[model samples]
Target: MNICVFLSAADLDERYTRPARALGELIGRGGHTLVWGGSDTGLMKVVADGAHETGGRLVGISVEFLRGFARTGADELVVATDLAERKALLLARSDAVLVLAGGLGTLDEVTEILELRKHGLHDKPVVLLNTAGFYDGLTQQLRRMEAEGFLPVPLDTLVHVADEPADALAYLERLPTAPQVR
Candidate 1:
């Protein structure tokens, strides 16, 4: 499967470093393709490196302006004209989306996917890796939204949460046989 990973462009928090690395390695060893922002920095670089080390196929999508920062090891590099295009291409190509611990930019990517799913834009599985409680606040806020009747559907119908990389893969493996509730 082609897995899209949304993560911090910079490793601002140390807690996520190891998980990011492990996730990348897991993706590679599992023979999954990685679709990500075309940059070799932060958690992005760590994941890319880990995947590359295990011979995982890497497909990077980014704006032409960021070409210099692109990961040299990517098997296929695509430079979109802009961020919107990048996101669109990423979403269209990925079989599933895995969100790792990240900052504002990561939050933006996560929201983009979640909002689209909420509207029935896509049925792809969206998994959030809640490492070290990185997404605790956001998860709470989402549940709060469902509780307050602001969300038209239950939060569980929109996204899945995994505590680790292995759990995330397990969720994906279960996706096919799992009943569709949406």
Candidate 2:
């Protein structure tokens, strides 16, 4: 499977690094292909490096604007002219998405993908790697949306949550195959 991971470009404290690396390793060992923001810094780098070290197929996608600042031109990268283009390519190429601890950018990406799924644009699975309960508030907010009938999606379609990397990968592996549309 081609798995797209949404993560921040900002330098993360050790709290976020460890799990990101572990998640990369697990995904690598599972023989899944990795797709992520092509950044050689922060948690993005940690995960990319971990996957590379484990001999996983790593494909990086980066926007032209961030290429110089992020210094992420890995051999596997597919560059785009803008963030939106990069995201569109990633979503088209990935079979699923794994979101790690990140800031606003990560949230935006996840929400966009979720909205895409809601509109029947895609049926890929999205999982939130909730390391140390970092996403507790967001999950609660989702629940609130469900209660208010603001979400037309089934609870299962929102996002899968896992406290650990291994668990997240396992859950993804068990997801029911998307049905044929035609």
Candidate 3:
């Protein structure tokens, strides 16, 4: 499987680093390809590094505008012109999406993917690596949307939460066999 992980390039704290690294390793060992933001800093770098260390095929998609500030080079990176283009390319090339702990940027990426899935733009699974209950509020908001009828998507369609990297990868592997999509 090809997994596209969404995470912030700013938060490189231990709280976010451990899981991102572990998850990347697990994804690589599990024989999955990794697609991620091309930046070589912060949590994004952690993930890419882990995957690359484990010998996983690493593919990066970065926005052209952020190329310099991001300090990510295209000699080894697959660069896109903008965020929208980058996201579309990632979504199109991946089999799943894993969201790690991040700030507003991460939230935006997750929400955008969710909305896209809702409209049948993609059928891939989206998994949230909820390390230390980081996404509790977001999960609650999603439930609220379902309750208020503002969200037409089934809970199963929106997100899958995992407490650890292993569990997250397991959930992803089992997604296609689950009865929900069928």
Candidate 4:
């Protein structure tokens, strides 16, 4: 599968980078492609490096201004005109979306992804890899929204929250055949 990963572009500590690397390596070892923001720094770089070292395919979606920072050795790289275009291309080129720890840009990407899925724009499975409880608050808020009927559909129908990379991979690998309930 072409697994798209939305993650931070900023340098972070090992707490964040370790799982990101592990997830990337897993994606590669499973014969999946790593589609990402294309930045060659921070967790993006770490994950891509892990994938590349394990013989995984890399597909990077980068914007025009950030082209200089794009990964140089990706199997494929596409430069979008803007962030919107980059996001669209990232979604278009992948079969599934995996979210690792990220900052503002990552947050923006995930919200848009979920919103689109909520509206049936796509049915691609979205997994939030909650490494080290990084997304604890966000998941809590999402569940609260579902509990209060703020969401149009059940939260489980929109995305799956996985605490570990292995869990996330297992949930994703079982999809379309066995749907996740929460």
Candidate 5:
């Protein structure tokens, strides 16, 4: 599977890095690909390193402005003209999306993906890796959206909330778009 991970570019606590590393390792060991923003710093680098070390393929989608910081030696690196194009390319190139602990940018990417899924634009599985309950508040807000009729589709159907890296990968692997396990 080509798993697109949207995550932080900032240096975070070990709480976040640990799960990111585990997820990347899982992706690599499973013979999957890591498709993500091309940044080579912080959690992005940590996960990419994990993937690379474990023999997983790397496909990076970076913006023109951020090209300087993009990961080197990626299996494939594509620089988009802008953020919108980058996001579109990232989604188009992946089988599933994993939202890790990140800041506003991570939220933005996940929101756009969810909106697209809600409108039936795509059926790719979306997993929110709730590391250290980082996303508990957001999940609650999402649930409220469902209850308030703000979301046309059930929140559960829209996104899977995972407490651990393994759980995240397991959920994605179970989805229809993922490769059939032998």
Candidate 6:
């Protein structure tokens, strides 16, 4: 399966580096493809490196302008014209999506995926790796959105929250083949 991971481009602190590497190794050992942003910095580099260490295939999608800073680890590189195109290609090519601990960019990507799901565009599984409760606040906010009727559907129907990388991998492993996003 091709698992798309949304993560920070910023360097990971010790808190996240270990698990990020583990997640990458898990994907590699399982023979799953790692799909992600094509940057060479931060968690992006870590995950790609970890996966590559185990001989896993990596697919990176990035805006054309970022190619100069893109990493060289990806086995396949896809250049998109803009952010919108990058997001579209990321969603379209993945069997499942993993949300790792990150900053604003990660939030934006996850929200976009949820928005897509809300519109009945896809039914693919989306899991949030809430390492060390990193996403607890966001999860609460999502619950609040649902409670306030701001969301079109229940939040759980759109994303799954996991506290560990192994757990997220388990969830992904259990998912059926991804359906085509409309």
The best candidate by TM-score is 5
lDDT of 3 at 95: 86
Q: lDDT by residue for model 5 over 1-182, one digit each (tens)?
A: 88999999999999999999999999999889999998999999999999999989999999999999999899999999999999999999998999999999999999999999999999898999999999999999999999999998888889999999999998888776677633
**lDDT (Cα, tens digit) per residue for candidate 6, span 6-99:** 9998886878988888999988888888899988889988888888888678999988988887887579999999988999999988989999
Per-model root-mean-square deviation over C-alphas: 3.4, 3.2, 3.6, 3.4, 1.2, 3.0
lDDT of 3 by residue, 1-182 (tens): 88899988885668789999998898777767788887778888888778877867777888887776443432246679878888898888788899998888788889999999898888888999888899999898888888999888787777888889899888988865432221
Error of 4 at 123 (Å): 0.2
Candidate 1 lDDT, tens digit per residue, 1-182? Answer: 88899987785566788888888898888888889996899899988988888867899987798888888868988999888888899999888999998878789889999999999999888999999988889999999999999889889988999999889977986776433222
Which candidate comes out best when scored by lDDT?
A: 5
* Candidate 4 lDDT trough over 10 residues, lowest sum: 173-182
Candidate scoring better on lDDT of 5 and 6? 5
Residue range 28-144, candidate 2, lDDT tens digits? 777777899888888988998788778678888888878864434454788899878988998987888999999998999999998898888988999999998999999999889
Clashing pairs in 6: none
Global lDDT of each model?
Answer: 0.87, 0.85, 0.82, 0.91, 0.93, 0.88
- Cα deviation at 8, candidate 1, in Å, is 1.1
TM-score of each candidate structure, all chains considered together: 0.93, 0.93, 0.90, 0.95, 0.97, 0.94
State the lDDT of candidate 4 residue by residue for 87-113, as single tens digits.
999999988899999989999999999
The residue-level lDDT of candidate 5 at 65 comes to 95
* Candidate with the larger lDDT of 1 and 4: 4
| TM-score sort, best first | 5, 4, 6, 1, 2, 3
Off by over 4 Å in 4: 177-182
Predict model 3's lDDT versus the native: 0.82
Model 1 clash pairs?
none
